[model samples]
Target: MDAGLKLRGIVAGYGQGDILRGLDLDVPAGQITCLIGPNGSGKSTVLRVISGLLAPRAGQVRLAGRNVTGWSPWAMLDGGVAHVPQERSLFPAMSVWDNVLMGAYINADRDAVARRATDIAQRFPLVARRRRDLAGSLSGGEQKTVEIARSMMLDPPVLCFDEPSIGLEPRARRTIFGILAELRRDGRTVLLVEQNARSGLAVADNGAVLDAGIVRLAAPASQLLDSPDVGRLYLGAS
Candidate 1:
């Protein structure tokens, strides 16, 4: 399969020390790849590097066959990579519609933004249903739905999500996973960093186990789920 995104020899960290050590990864096009690991395993850091939140001290980041290493967040977005961070980025005082519209901030074409907004509203009914409501008024799941919808404003080819199902109810998590499946069906390459290893692998086409900032294991999601080594090492099974 062709890779939608590639990371080679990635070495990055914060402040003084490094967290990622010669990390390498490949996210295949038109599929979902989940990264799972113990806390401090550099899973989130990988997303940051891919989304341009952090620059790799070494290594390359390629998107759609183009080298995008060290690109700024805005540049990455413009280059077809959309990141939906773990934190809630919506404005509490803003209406849901306005919050969704913010996704097109980089776009100067008003007519295009309007057309995308309408398409997004249709795709994520919650955005249209709560169009007049304050973003803060919605539930956690609703907010996440809006976030994903907003991400589609640019119709990016690559989407990276960090802990998307974090702090959500079981039903909400399922909803989020369902959306992930839908995105895959839409032919978007998705890189997911999730703490819920089982659920993450369940929704993923491929799974990578990150340990000590490097890929320890990479395989089909089903294979990883059934692997005794994966169970003992990360899935907490005996």
Candidate 2:
């Protein structure tokens, strides 16, 4: 598969200290690419750069062969990039249906948004099941499904997820991973940053190990999964 998003010699940081130092990586299109690493490894920072939340101090950000370095979030969204942030981004007071429709807010055509919402609702029954309930009232797993369903409103080609399975029960995590697999089957490019290396690699077509802001290994998911070093470091192998 081709790269949907590419980072070349990326350098970014908050203060004088650079968290990502000359990092280089590619998220392949139409497949799930999981980024696994320890805390403070600049994993989330990479997502921020791709989503236009943080401007890289150096290097380039490319999407679908277009240069999008330093583009605003709106610009990125217009270029078919959808970012599902790590934090709870839904409006708690709004109904689940309303929250899902919020993803279509960028478009001016109200009717088109509604039409798309209908399609999304059909794809995710959870949206219809809890359409009348407040977004905050749902369980964690349900909220995740709603969030993912909202992302589909734009029909984006690329989807970026940050720690998607965080703070969820085993069943919820399984549900989330299954959703990711379904996305892959739909031919969407998925860039996933996951703390659970084992689970992440299990669902990904490609896996890259990041440490101290740079990629230490990039290979097929199976290869990485079979690596003894990787298993010992991240997979909790004895």
TM-score of each: 0.98, 0.98
Decoy 2 TM-score against native: 0.98
Candidate 2, clashing residue pairs?
none
lDDT of each: 0.94, 0.93
Across 1-238, the per-residue lDDT of candidate 2 in tens digits comes to 3448899999998988899999999888999999999999999999999989999999999998889999999999878889898888889999999999999889999999999999999999999989999999999889988999999999998999999899999999999999999999999999999999999999999999999999999999999999999999988986
Worst-scoring 10-residue span by lDDT in model 2: 1-10
Model 2, residue 66: displacement in angstroms?
Answer: 0.8
Q: Least accurate stretch of 10 residues (summed lDDT) in model 1?
A: 1-10
Candidate 1: tens digits of C-alpha lDDT, residues 1-238 = 3439989999999998899999999999999999999999999999999999999999999887889999999999998889999998889899999999999999999999999999999989899899999999999999999999989999998999999999999999999999999999989999999999999999999999999999998999999999999999878889
